[model samples]
Target: MNEQLEFVVRAAAIGTGATAVMDLWGLFLKRTLAIPPLDYAWVGRWIGHFPRGRFAHANIAQAPRIRGETPVGWVAHYTIGIVFAALLMAVWGLDWARDPTLLPALVVGMSTVVAPFFIMQPAFGAGIAASKTHNPSTARLRGLITHLSFGVGLYAAALFSAHLFPI
Candidate 1:
């Protein structure tokens, strides 16, 4: 495969794998600790209104439901994962993907917290980093753990890919 095509494929796989790991972690948290997972429908609802210049909501749950909100949110979630993976590749390069390091993946994953802290949470009416939510600390911890898991996922995916396509 061409260099660009290979990179694209690797990035997609890494992101998808990372997202899957995050989802699995979410499921574990939900099942073991009774922690609830994020509502993607709300995310969709928030995004759905962006075209209407309605970025902030007092309560996304109460926001008017939008058509195909669930699908939109899910797609956006996965796409964001891809973007993060691409970011990791951009910073660390294909050599890292082949060798599989932990720090860069973790850093990129943890850095992704900025997205929710500044944009997503605030727009969804949860305040920055879910400050306005029922339990801010708990919410923050959950996010931190989730993001960390995504970082591990990124590394794991890289290792797995390298094994599969060893030079």
Candidate 2:
């Protein structure tokens, strides 16, 4: 494969793996502590309203439901993951993927919280960093932990890719 194509493939794989890891972490939390995972359907609803010129909501839960929201949300979730992975590679270079390291992955992963804190959360009507939620601190903590897990996933996925591809 050509260099750019190989990079794209690798980024997609790494991002998917990282997103899966994040989901697994959510599942673990839910199973062990009864903590519910994020309902991506809300994300879909938010995105679904895009064409209607609706961006921000006071309470996304109160927003009207969109058709195929669940699928759209899930796809957006994974696509975001892939974009983040591609960003990591872009900043650190493909060499980082070949010789994977924890710090860079973690940095990129954790930093992704910026999106939800500023963009997604606000647009979802949760306020910045989920401040409008019932419990902002807990919400923030959960988000941090989730993002941290994604960071770990990035490292793990990169390591796995290196082992599997060896190129």
Candidate 3:
């Protein structure tokens, strides 16, 4: 396959893998830990509560239910994953996508938690660095673990795809 096509395939694989991992994490958190599934609709309602400060950061737990559309939030979530994968490729090359190491990939993936803690969560009104949650430490830890799993998923998917395609 051409290099461009290869890149696209690898990036998509990474993104899909990350999404799957995240979904599994959500499921486990809900089923095992009794945490509710993250609802983008609720998040939308929360954002809508403050029309003037729609984009401003606040504590999501305290913010009113989201009221507007949810597609933007969902898109942002997946796009972040895709961007992470692309960055990995840029740093380590296409070969890394096929055989991603745990250290670098996990590190990169975990690093992504900062964005949600400081940016998206706050923008959604979660709080700066998870300050709104009753148990911020646990939430932060869960986020880290989940993102690490996503990195592992990316590696596993790349390996499987490589096996299927054989370079």
Candidate 4:
């Protein structure tokens, strides 16, 4: 394979693996803290409306339901994870994946919070950084923690990859 292509392949693997780690963390939080996991169905509903000319919602729960929204949401969730992983590779380079450092992975992971804070939140009607939610500050804090976890996930995935591939 070409050098760039090899990088992309490795990046995809790392990103997807990292996302899986993040998801496991989410499950742990839900079980330990009694916090309900995110309902990707809402994310699907939000995305489903795009073609119909809707972009933002006052409350996603109030939005019309979409068929197969759960599956769609899950797909989006994992896909987003892969994208984040790819982004980590892009910024830190494939060498990071080979060596598996901490700061770079964590930094990239935390920075991903912007997507939910500004894009996903506002689009879902929660406002920027979840400002429109009933408890905006709490919501924001949770989001930060979640993103930080993702950063940790990135590190874990990279470490695992290094162990497995050992290139």
Point to the candidate with the largest TM-score: 2
- Tell me the tens digit of each residue's lDDT in model 4 across 1-167: 56687577767677777777777877998899987657889989988998999989989989999888889988898788878888888877878888978999889888998999989999988899988888999888888888888888888877887787777
Per-residue lDDT tens digits for candidate 2, residues 1-42, read 777987998899899999999999999999999999999999
Model 1 lDDT per residue over 43-131, tens place: 88888999999999998999999999999999989999988998899889988887888999999989988898889999888999999
Superposed by TM-score, candidate 4 places the C-alpha of residue 82 at a distance from the truth, in angstroms, of 1.0
> Model 3, residue 59: displacement in angstroms?
5.2
Clashing pairs in 2: none
Error of 1 at 115 (Å): 0.7
Q: In candidate 4, which residue ranges exceed 4 Å CA deviation?
A: none
Q: How much is the lDDT of residue 65 in candidate 1? A: 98
> How many Å off is the CA of 41 in candidate 4?
1.2
Estimate TM-scores for all models.
0.96, 0.98, 0.80, 0.93
Model 3 lDDT, full chain set:
0.71
lDDT (Cα, tens digit) per residue for candidate 3, span 45-109: 54465556566645455555444448755665677678788787888898877666767777777
User: Scored by CA lDDT, what does every candidate get?
Assistant: 0.90, 0.95, 0.71, 0.83
Q: Which segments of model 3 are wrong by more than 4 Å? A: 42-53, 57-68
Give the least accurate 10-residue stretch of model 2, judged by summed lDDT: 1-10
